[model samples]
Target: MLHLDASSSSNSKAISDTCNIDLNSIIKIETQLQDNPYDMISLVFLLYDVPDTALQRLIVYQRVMSDVSETNINLLQEWYCHASSRPNWQHELLEALMICQLNSIVKSLGFHIPTMRVFYLSSDPFGSKYINPVKKILYHACENIDSTNLKKLKKSLLSYDINVMEHTTCEIIFLELMSKKFITINISQENKTDEGIMYNVENIVNILDKLNGLKKIVNSLRYLQSKPNHDTIKLKQDNTNYGVDDFNDLFDLINQIMPNTLENDD
Candidate 1:
């Protein structure tokens, strides 16, 4: 359990923060997994976000091979190509490996898995499934939007059966979307913790882009980068669990993105 501490070196930061994998590393890793291409395919299967049926369709369409070993290897390579096309493929791959319990390979490759809190604070949304800064940033971006943008946002959600009210705040709209499962959070009810809720936020970013609010979000992130302390908010270390106030402060760090605009806006 390697946590991404604030003390990580600059060179390490370059590797840990990014989802990009070098060609040489990719080649070496693939070669190492030649002995168990089946495990490799399983890892690829986990890395894929789509349903298993989609993967089966891809396999049938691309490489319908009779030889099991060769087919598995080819499929692994194909999946690597597909996964690498995604912006956060490396992070996704690391997560997939963890899920597949490939600890030996993970250690051999020197993959560092950061805590969900660290991922939430990071600029990369794909680092963890945690819902925090990204969600809060989008929510703040929606605050005090003009009527035109509101109409645009409303129209976008019409397909999801979300009727945005003239006076509805961003919080209310997001809550509604979450309730309807249009916006999902990755949290387990059986093992609930203050670790933070996981969410897929790219859709929110796309919606904000349509409303012309993406620029504001970008600027807000730039502000956070300039003031890193604001982004690296320390959660209270009291109990094994956290209370409501601690959670509020944890997620509300995005409010510092643009105080005058997000906070004071009506």
Candidate 2:
């Protein structure tokens, strides 16, 4: 009888330990997202509980941009956590974004850490609305094969890490996007920033020049096309250093830069 009691007690302790670990993990996620996620990336992936009347109007104003999926949102948050911690986390983001159909919406979810706010704003505030025809090349590249395609894309994406810093490299893609010319943005900066967070003409010109340098590989047709110099951008995510929450920062930035861009809830 004593042995049976001991066994049950041991089992209960084990279960309790497991539960505690899981709970801690969940709390960690909440803290990371809420408290100090901005140190990792300028753009944040998050949701808001605020009244949606204002957000809904923005959606209607924008011709009902595609919906952001819950699964992708979770995946992005997970990726953000990993990317903030581990350097190799980009593979997960690239793969997830590739498989996720809600790329358009996913692209817009940037968070500010200070206030725990979420905003939908374009990253490229001043680039032209131009596109490279071969972007489909990347899409098709992923479609034609099996594990090999995934492997190749992973390799290609990860290859950028060979020279550039981990998370900061993602900023380079924004420059690449501008070079492709698929972006046109109008940003209003009430005040100036040393970071040039606003999308003004000078910002556009500086980005274009820096972007061209990154893609200027010797004689290679594949990547010779202009790409943003991944090395130029610095990463901002650090738990130790405090800043605005990803969600709030994005909202404030968008609200400040493009006040009319998002429709008011009322």
Off by over 4 Å in 1: 1-20, 49-72, 112-266
Error at 167, model 2, angstroms: 29
The candidate maximizing lDDT is: 1
lDDT of 1 by residue, 1-266 (tens): 12222223324333333323545556666767766644554543344333343335334523433455553344445556665543444544554555445556655554332222232334543222312243345444554467687777778887656675642345445545555556544444344444433445555556766666467775554443343222111121122222233323322432333333333321
Give per-model TM-scores.
0.33, 0.23
- Per-residue lDDT tens digits for candidate 2, residues 1-266, read 00101222234334222222122333344344332222112222111111132123222322322343312123224434434452223322322222322333223222122111122112321111111112222222223334443333234534343322222223233333333332222212342222322122222233333322322211121331343212111122112222123213333344454444333311
lDDT of 2 at 225: 31
Worst 10 residues of 1 by lDDT: 229-238
Provide the global lDDT of candidate 2 against the true structure.
0.27
